[model samples]
Target: MAQQAYMTETDNQGSGHEPRGTRIRRLMSRLANRLFAGGRDGRGIWRRGMVLTALAVLVGLIMLLHAQVPNTIGNSGSLIETFLPWLGVSVPVLLVLALVRRSATALIAVLFPAIVWLNLFGGLLGDKAGTGGDLTVATHNVNADNPDPAGTARDVAASGADVVALEELKTSAVPVYEKALASTYRYHSVQGTVGLWSKYPMTGVRAVDIQLGWTRAMRATVTTPEGQVAVYVAHMPSVRVKMEAGFTARQRDKSADALGEAIADEKLTKVVLLGDLNGTMNDRALNGVTSQMRSTQGAAGSGFGFSWPASFPMARIDQILVKGIEPESSWTLPETGSDHLPVAARVSVDTSS
Candidate 1:
């Protein structure tokens, strides 16, 4: 009987059976450990992915908004083109974020602003070199307060421009400019605060209403060797500075719109617009003009070509725009007595077009 009992006890131990309650507890403990491990790993991955996605979306939104703002406002001091190059930075940053997160959706979203920005400013990035027949034209803002009109006229004549357009012309300096430039240009006319001097025959010269008193803008026909071309010289209203309102950009914007409408209605095919625009090509307000006409400097110049306040030029307020002409080369000339530097261009009149 003792042997039987001992054998039975050993068999029960070797069978590996525990009380039901203990077995259930052991199984539950194992399951809880597995569940906790899985939850921890999942949470860590989710957090990392969320952080990366949020960063990408945030950067992309900022870039989009920045690209949408119109560069020019009434009296805004900053030029629009200065901020155009920053879009390039945004594109790369978004691309890097997309790669790091491995988010295909975010990568796709980045293309919207990238395309818009490039479409508007892509031409500025490429090489602007091209060949065409030579037709020299010059544009300058002579500054109403210019002290040395003779010096300014002499400098303008030195540029070898076939046509010269002057802005901010004051009555006091008119005689000096007339005397200095008289020997070079055979034809000249002053409508209001602006004037045009040309080597070729100028006729049908009349003032254009650009919202300034009298005649701040005028159009003339230049009989060149190739053909007749219409040239417009304009000096838009000066943008005022005030502490109450950030740059009063509305007036300039309205003028630009009106000017654009006028230009669009003109019967002439070949047109050249020269002046101190008080804004740059990248400014959205100037889109009224910039969208219709091609800027010679932007097409063929080597650098940013900033031409305003010549002593420390931060913006290219002075400009030469061409329509129905192929620009070959463009550059800024040495400073004269005026506050703005002269911008010159060599263009080819495409009469065939």
Candidate 2:
């Protein structure tokens, strides 16, 4: 009778919930204690996961001093720089592993990569584009196998760009693009696999030899109301990645050098270069061109403005670089049937310059 009375009183006081909750809390506490039990010896947080700690530090150093990394080994340095921004992804993975191992050392070491990544790429996360621009130009590498060439042409025309550059043009489909874009662009020129359509009058239209033994580049003077601006359209040789050959870009690099040389010779003060360079400005291989020009995307675009493999853009290979023109804003257009998404930039064109 005494035990029965005590049980009824206990159940009435808290309905037995408090004891169950307390037990669960205690169980969690025990697990935590076991996980963090050792602090001064083997199996301790400081001593565990040293490899992870080392890896984190190494990743940080690589990003911090990526330029120092040599390109001698299969142009490994260039390859790394190509996707350098993605290196930040390793930080979170290392952090998770450190937590699983309860490793304080690794936790601290992960900060190295975290900090390095933030320092390198954090600036790109914010908005830098300004308002107001006189000229809107767009570029696209419409694939040769596009199922709807006419549709692709129409999509590009819809961007309302004063100047449009199309690369990788197929001989048979040139007529389709001409007819589709004819309504929007009155003045246009096609040189080899590349073409330029302009709302303004185009003069000095001719092929630019990029040392490819054929014309894959061209230059024309677009007489915009603001003034005449030299526009260059180019398609650098494509690069391939083979297990044995690594980033086989020797051909592309040579082509880039030739193209850069051509741009450097432009007489016009205001110039706009549009193309699929097959490489990024971060890449040292394009220094011949990048050294002189300014990237509109880097100067005025929001985010990375990646414009390749239209399905999921990852890198900003398509570029709109300017000399003497000021980019007010830059952006990537909606995907068309082409493999590449069109990239456009609005810029302040001062003819007097």
> Over the stretch 16-48, how does candidate 1's per-residue lDDT look in tens digits?
466799879989988655533234345432243
lDDT of 2 by residue, 1-353 (tens): 87677768777553545567878998999987777667556577678888999999999999999889887778887788788888988999999998888888999999999998988888778778988888999999999999999999988889889899999999999999999999999999999999999999999999998889988999999999899899999999997888997887888889889888888889988999999998887888889889989999988989888987799887888999999999888999989988899999999997344
lDDT of 1 at 90: 71
lDDT of 1: 0.77
For this target, which candidate reaches the highest TM-score against the unseen true structure?
A: 2
> Using Cα atoms with residue i matched to residue i, what is each candidate's TM-score against the true structure?
0.70, 0.88
110 Cα displacement, candidate 1 (Å): 13
TM-score between candidate 2 and the true structure: 0.88
